[model samples]
Target: MKSETYKITNAVVEDIITETSNIKTFVLKPDKGLEFKTGQFVELAVKGLGEAPFTPSSDPGISEKIDMTIMKVGLVTDAMHNMKKGEILGIRGPYGQGYPIDDFKGKRVCVIGGGVGLAPLRSLLYELMHDLSRFEKVSLYYGAKTPKDIVYKNYVKKLQQEKELDLFLTVDQADDSWTGNVGVVTTILEDLNPENSIACVCGPPIMMKFSTLKLLEIGFKEEDIYLSMEKNMSCGVGKCGHCRIGNYYACKDGPVFTYAQIKNFDEIWD
Candidate 1:
């Protein structure tokens, strides 16, 4: 497992689905099938353009093809946005620790996401829904800057219709056609039964910070709050200090960690 973690395998871009104005999901077919834990990430790259870390948004159960939902945020992503169907990219990983799904068994699982952060959580949701009998309840609460900014439009519709899952959505700003809650995601976080439940959070650092505070106010324990910290992670392995946080490395020890494992670090939100 350690040997394959750093090896880059070639993958072809089979298709791309435009999710929003800024985000798109790339369907990649690697030379060999790659399997990863739901919340684990892969380092995707072009031969010369360099690599970046991204959590696969596809269900972990399907390893034949990997789906990566990326936003056009920087140079690498901009080039990727312009890539054609036949283009190739390098892939490395299944790295870092993923969501401990086994430990979450028999407990209520709440997933919270904002904007593109939903990409990673979507994979987790798939696994939860795949085996719904393992948990007591499964719920998703997600928010975006505006109705137009919401990713996975059609997929979210199906999520809403799933009888075993509870889904809630909110937008920071609403247009004339928007009918959902018209406030930040925290506005709809009320009435949560934090006891005996576990929550996973991912989003912009500011949104993550405040959402965590809200979860705490509602009585969620720090040990039960998992945060996805994917900031400035250049090299997926531990050698690169780009993702260092105090004594631990986000890309190595985590990208996923419970709140109690990292809340003491002052630079976590940075």
Candidate 2:
């Protein structure tokens, strides 16, 4: 992979779409086009502060700007919350091979996303939802900490309206006012048939680990199960040693990878 660093001459904080308290969507435009794939991530830098790898939550085709729905969970991201509109930042490429959309053609695709991990998967969902005919069935299972924690609330609602697509939502624990499925994300996976379909999993380490296990038990092939490995990725171009999970570089080799690719790696979640 080559280095593709660009300055964010134009940046803006878009609407706080979901009232997920700690999570919000930021819409940013580059000085020039910063094209990338759905599963690939970019290195977001706040000058003199720090940088972190974040997946673009916008459609892969829309090169004008990118939307990153981030959760304020760490140092750099917390600093990001303090940033105002028009503040310039640093960004880089749409690296890595995304989901095998081509292979999924004419086949049902199942997407399971948990918490902030839903951001990257939303990019793929955006693209897939646009052209529903290209796919057989698009079933999405998204889980969050609570009902209010769900991101992309409007989009998920619209997806539910599409008869061709089935959207399953669950909350770990809900308030007295909320009524919906209550359990782990893996529990929702049981409601679907993994046979002859592609399964994509992204979430907190524990959620994804168990989700993968459940998918395999439901008959999804190991190679057919795609996982977006969440790790500390510094240099999005692979130079930084922060995202290394053995010989593999999460920034370069993944952020998105098949289970067959990294299942044997030691302490992958560590």
Candidate 3:
């Protein structure tokens, strides 16, 4: 890691969009762009509370402001959720290896996400959607606890109208308003043509495990599958030892890794 990795930049809260009951998208404007790639993450710090790593959820092409979708899960996130527009937050780094978009060209792509896991994958989607001609096909399979808990309702609805992209949705438990599949996200992977394709997955531990298994069961190669570990990394740099999985430092080597690179680790899914 470089010395500059520890330096924090000032980012002002421009707006906050309530995505679901407990999830929000924070709009932050730094003096300049954070310029992060699709899967790389940054540390967002509250003035006094603390900081946590979050992947940027907005378009990778946009430069002025960045969007980070956060679930109110911990001390830093809880404080961030309570913050108002115009509050100044500290931003540092566009750390770790991002999705290698070039490798995805000329191949079918599947993005699988669960709950807030969609946040990081959302950035990859924007990059893929930016130039649809670069890939053979692109599809998204997502599931949440319920219809109301779905993170990006308007955005998902709009994707349906876009013929270029395929969207399949499901909820574990449904209400009257639900019309999609009602099982785990892996349920939707049954119909996909896993051959000549690559799948990128992010979610809670259980979700990541089954999604990987489902993808493998359906004929996807282990090396062709990508996962965002998104572990509780206390420091953005590898020295903290908080994000080490076996010999690899997930902070420095990857938050995004191919299944073949990490499938041997017993705690990978945890």
Candidate 4:
């Protein structure tokens, strides 16, 4: 029999890392170990403030503790940001389907993330890095509103030096300290070869839409491009229709799906 899906497990905030001005990464130690595939998300609940779905930003290989990188976007997340270490919270799920990393073996993989959307892609990145030989090439294209908004700043800098990975960074607007690429994330796509490659993308709806178009223009097949469709995912299960996109439920069927799987869905870009 399948395990209970609605049970909420208790977890304690172990540590917190500030990623950007408005984003923070919370380290939580669950009462019991939790193992989840990269790209899967969990519904994190603050006692009286309610809950919201967030993807784990830490390595999926480690279950002792999980990291959730969250932005203070709304009431639930605002409470999460203000939550102190040792405070208690509830966790449910590792919900929705994750990226098909296994299918990416022997092929080139390209990941593109904008702003906090990088949270889920970060998990997938670490999973792919764990098995470096599985793919011919691994490239990450990341963008933020400004240099200060970049998440995992130090780590992203380190990734640029790794011979096995190709890392590209961009900002919508440049600051005095910013000297790197200045443009949208999709601007870097011109340098990427879509041949024998699959792309995994997540970001604001506008960014995802343009990135998908760029990938297609450069030859990425619709079926090979995976998208994270995280809308109003209140319930991690499909019982609630809050996250519905056409016939599919973003929570149950996917928060991760190929462009082809949802291309026909009206208002997918919304």
Candidate 5:
């Protein structure tokens, strides 16, 4: 039988790594292992502080521990950043629909992420990396506000050196020491072949909008493009109506959706 969605499990913060000035990756070891798919999220909570949804940055193949990359954005996350290793927290999910990686076999995969949005995409990427033969090709296009804002710097550097995948990085502005591409994430989409390929995108509202437009402009089908919608979710389950997108509940029907699935929804670009 499946576990209850509302049942909270205790987890220990085994390690914490500062990814950027404002973002940190928390490595948590749950009392009971969390078996989650690539794009699913978990509801993490502290006793007094509130809970928020965050996708696991670690690979799903690693059941021993899961990594959550969080940005110090609001009250709950602020408290999370101040939290120390060995502290106990609550985890209540591996919720929502994940990426359809199984259907991607023998097809080229393109991933685009901006800033902390890379967190969820990282999980999918790791799963893809684990078995390169499952796909024809893989490409990653990432962008941040500045070099200092880049998360998972060291790991991304190693991915850049791997000959199996194509990695591209960009920033809105470049410092004196920076010499890489300086533009939006969509700039790299120019050279990618949309034929027999699928695109997965996650980022700020504006970024996701423009990225989707660019992908469509480059011949990718609406059904072939996947998007991670960052709707306001109070509950990981469908009980709360906070994450509703038109007739669908983001928490239940999706957090991961195809462009064809959500393209008709009002204010989707907003």
Candidate 6:
């Protein structure tokens, strides 16, 4: 694909569901449907302000529109919040290597996501749900700062009820109204028997670091554990060097990468 030549098709914003005070899910429809794999990401732009890479939170099957979970942590995201429905925006990509779903056929799958990290992970979970027969057992452990921080509340609930998959959740601090487990996401690592499971994880740098340790201690191979990374990616293509972590570009090489591929990079987990 060529760089800097993408068409500004349709950029209308659809539904805006506030997941939390700092997080919101934006639905966008491009001119043509986006055919993307589970772990791919796209670069969204607001003209002169800049562009940032975001993973699509919607399922791969539903391609007419894309869903992006944005956290209000930066200038561009703050501008995104003020955007109204039907407002035009610019989008490029469906980039990077995604999860190897075909290899997981009839194999156990484990997914761990924390905070806004659940955005990309949620899309994978949804894809697995649609093809339940392809995999043997599916398990998900999702965590957030508090009960209010959890995104896709009803969808997680539905996954628990309908699918045979084991769904676990945790929170940092609990209020009087809170009822789920109280701790970090790593707590759920104890429940998994990693004899034959492929795990994918996405979260803050600290969470990912500790989670990788726990997964390793429990017999999960480093190669079997995938981690999503983020640095400063200006251009989604390999032309820019901002997102480099050692020799790899977070935008081109991955937003999703196996732990084995990144263990040698000193600054990756920091």
Better of 2 and 4 by lDDT: 4
Model 3: worst 10 consecutive residues (lDDT sum)? 1-10
Model 4 clash pairs are none
Residue-level lDDT of model 3, residues 14-118, one tens digit each, is 999999988999999987677888999999999888889999999989867999999999899999999999999999878888999999999999999999999
Give per-model TM-scores.
0.97, 0.92, 0.97, 0.97, 0.97, 0.95
Full-model lDDT for every candidate: 0.91, 0.81, 0.90, 0.91, 0.91, 0.86
How do the residues 1-270 of candidate 6 rate in per-residue lDDT, one tens digit apiece?
Answer: 554454444577877888899899999988778888989988888867867778899998988989999998888899998888888778888878888888778788999999999999989988998878888889999889999899988787797796478889899988888888999999877978887788989988899888999999999999999898877767767777788877788878887888898889889887
Predicted candidate 5 versus true structure: per-residue lDDT over 1-270, tens digit per residue = 666657788999999999999999999999999999999998999878779999999999987799999999999999999999999989988889999899899999999999999999999999999999899999999999999999999989999899999999999988987889999988878887999999999988899999999999999999999999998877878987899888888888889999999998998867
lDDT of 1 at 148: 92
Model 3 regions more than 4 Å off: 1-5
Clashes of each: 0, 0, 0, 0, 0, 0
Predicted candidate 2 versus true structure: per-residue lDDT over 1-270, tens digit per residue: 323354333444433343478887888877777888788888778878887778988898898879988889888889887777777767766665677688888878999999998999999888887787888888899999998888888877787797888889899998896778999898888867766788888889999899999998988989988999988776566775777877788888887888988888888765
- Cα RMSD (angstroms) for every candidate in the order listed: 1.3, 2.1, 1.2, 1.2, 1.3, 1.5
Per-residue accuracy of model 1 over 127-161 as CA lDDT, tens digit each? 88889999999999999999999999999999989
Could you tell which candidate, 2 or 4, scores higher by TM-score?
Answer: 4
Candidate 4 Cα deviation (angstroms), residue 100: 0.7
Prediction 3 global C-alpha lDDT: 0.90
Runs of candidate 1 with Cα error greater than 4 angstroms are 1-5
Question: Which stretches of model 6 miss by more than 4 angstroms?
Answer: 1-8
- After TM-score superposition, the amount by which residue 80's alpha carbon in candidate 3 deviates from its true location, in angstroms, is 0.7
Q: Candidate 5: which stretches are off by over 4 Å?
A: 1-5
Off by over 4 Å in 4: 1-5
Return the lDDT, model 6, position 72.
Answer: 87
Q: For candidate 6, list the clashing residue pairs, or say none.
A: none
